[model samples]
Target: MTKTIVITGTSRGIGFELVKLFAAEGHTVFALSRNDKPVKGLNLDNVFTFSCDLNKASEVSEVAASIKSQVESVDVLINNAGQFLKQEFKDTKMEDVKSVYETNVFSVFDLTHKLLPLMKESTHVVTISSMGGVQGSMKFPGLAAYSSSKAAVITLTELLAEEYKENGPSFNVLALGAVQTEMLEEAFPGLEAPISALDMAEYIKDFSENGQRFYNGKLLQVSSSTP
Candidate 1:
């Protein structure tokens, strides 16, 4: 069966790899990103690239409407778009924290809320989070804004899953560890991660396709390293 998967932040990293992986498997992928050029460059027939900034509520609504118009049903929604903030707690401004939340937290809610009508019981909503967000996980400094924002979505996933448990899509979150992506490089300069973007995407692709059967409303710690 060819699945219709909606992935955000498809310009690079795990989301970009996911677009290629799904398209190669003959799945229809709706790739949303600030810059569509990377996914567009591939020119895969199965992939549809949309230039979108999740932080913009209007853009999120418009993209959801566009997706609904194109696909009758969406099998998966991967909330992979996030804004990283690496300032110290004392130095982090309210505006900076809000900006991070705009992309990492609020946008996930906006896009998912709009597209949720097209989802079915069989559909899966996989949200990408960070290990820094996981409760009791090893914590790191200079990530107060980023980690707190991630935690918000983890709880939101649990709430949504329970709310829609009767006849709605499964909602789950993956609290990821260090992955060697540009985001990681930007966050922790010169630090190398054991997992690559493509490898993590592979795990997520498989999970998005089948993890719902075993889990829903659960936060899986997909990490091998500390914060």
Candidate 2:
């Protein structure tokens, strides 16, 4: 059974690895990233690479519309793209905070909203959040905008799951711990993570494909480190 999967932030890290993994498994994948070249460079037989800036609602809507026109139904949609702002709350500007939300919260809503028509009852929506976003978790310094925006999406996923529980398309959010990715390097320089990007992607790939059978509209804390 082949499935069509749509994933954002496909240019690098876990999203990039997931794209390749799914393509290798012979699934159709719509890969969205600001720089499409990375996935496009793969030239996978089943992948449709799109250059998209999630910060812009129009771009997210356009991508969803394009995907809607092509796929009969979306089996899974992964909101993997995120904006990280490593600034203290006192020093962070209003524009910086808005930019973070534009990608983390607003874009997730826009893409999911537009793509709902293409998702069937069995479809699964997986959103990638952060351990920092988890309430009462050990707070990190200089991530007020980024962490809060992630929290917003977590709530959004929960609400969407409840609203669609009677219908279909299970929604879930993953609060991830430290993973060795470019984003991690940027956020915490010289820090080593127990998990690699590929490792985490493998977990998410499996979860996106089968986790809905066991859980919906739930937040799963996926961290190897204490948070």
Off by over 4 Å in 1: none
Residues 121-147, model 1: lDDT tens digits: 999999999999988988888999999
TM-score for each candidate, following the candidate numbering: 0.98, 0.98
lDDT of 1 at 88: 78
Please report, as a residue range, the 10-residue window in candidate 2 with the lowest summed lDDT: 55-64
lDDT to native, each model: 0.94, 0.93
lDDT of 2: 0.93
Candidate 2 lDDT, 1-227, residue by residue in tens: 99999999999999999999999999999999999999999988899999999988778878888998888899999999998899877898999899899989998898988899898999999999999999999888899999999899889999999999998989999999999999999998898999999999999999999999999999999999843
How high is the lDDT of residue 77 in model 2? Answer: 96
